[model samples]
Target: MFGLGAYRRWLRSDRVRLGRWGERRARAFLRRRGYRIIARNWRCPAGEVDLVAADPSGPIAFVEVKTRRDEHWAPGQQAVHERKQQHLARVAQWFARRYGLKDRSLRFDVIVVVVPETGRVEVRHYPSAFRPPC
Candidate 1:
């Protein structure tokens, strides 16, 4: 039997490995879709956006990525609660203002990452997932 400390360490390591794997899957999916990745793991006082990308149309997108091993509890997109949405909007606004992108078009997106036990990853991208604050 594993001691408490050993179990905790195992859990932490597992989480870290899962996170990195999810991020890699997200990047690969985006690249295959022809979207140019501008940033990853962008953080601010408000919140963090997992990925930011731009298309040929000049619209900048802020993406929220949720990864899960199973869809038993809820779908990955459903994980973005109301509070999380608000934080994402705030952070996106800050990003726009800081970069003087006010006049440019912007959008919010969500990417759901589902990793099966076989290690295959499925990513679903939802464009314009939410509206920015007025």
Candidate 2:
């Protein structure tokens, strides 16, 4: 029998693996669309931003990736609620300041990856997902 703590650890590790896989898919999707990947899993005092990319002749994109096994519960993008957006915004602000990108245009994006049992994966990208509340 597995102890509660061990089960929790296993679950956490599984989720981490899923997230990493999803981020890879997201990166490929962005690359195919002409976005230059700047960073992956970038972190700051505020929080973590999954992927940072420079769009071709466009604003820098701060991406948040959500991975799920299925969409029965809800679409992965829906998981990025208001509080999550705020967290991402804070992280983006910190990253921008650190990289001297304050003067450059920036936007938030969400990438949702759904991996189902059928061996097919779905990726949905939302550009300009939301604006940070002032």
Candidate 3:
């Protein structure tokens, strides 16, 4: 019974809610694996990063979280394409400069969360998934 605009808005809000839930799950998963969460939903002029965490013995991680339902066609991580990587790289640089972490090692990570309406939730982590262009 909803109009086109209303349906689009509802879908967008639903996606946002799902994304936030996935981020929370990803945070818990990372904490269980000994990664210290530094920030959530960090945003700047370049773009936004879903989560930023520090590995116990490795580089700081700029995590991109992709959340989906079912994911029968394509995995959520696939959504983080080249252009998105470049965008995150820029945001990471800005974050590092602002936080005085320029000299420290940095890494890009992708966390794919699949939440099925009638099945168990799934999470896949990809560490150092991509490198920024020089």
- Mind giving the per-residue lDDT tens digits that candidate 1 earns over 1-134? 99999999999999778877787788788778888998898888877888888866779988888878888899988887777888888988878887788988888888888887887778888888877545
Estimate, for each residue in 23-126, the C-alpha lDDT of model 3 and write its tens digit: 99999999999999999999999989999999998789999998889888888878888899899999999999999997899999999988898879989999
User: lDDT of each structure?
Assistant: 0.83, 0.94, 0.93
Candidate 1 off by > 4 Å: 132-134
- Local accuracy of candidate 2 as per-residue lDDT tens digits, 1-134: 99999999999999999999999999999999999999998988998899999999779999999999999998988898889999999999999999999889999999999999997999999999899776
User: lDDT score, residue 96, model 2?
Assistant: 91
In candidate 2, the residue pairs with backbone N, CA or C atoms under 3 Å apart (3 or more residues apart, or in different chains) clash, namely none
**In model 2, where do residues sit more than 4 Å from their true spots?**
none
Give the TM-scores of the predictions, in the order they appear: 0.86, 0.95, 0.95
Each prediction's RMSD over C-alphas, in Å, is: 2.0, 1.0, 1.1
What's the lDDT for residue 90 in model 1? 90
After aligning candidate 1 to the native by TM-score, how far in Å is the CA of 46 from where it should be? 1.9
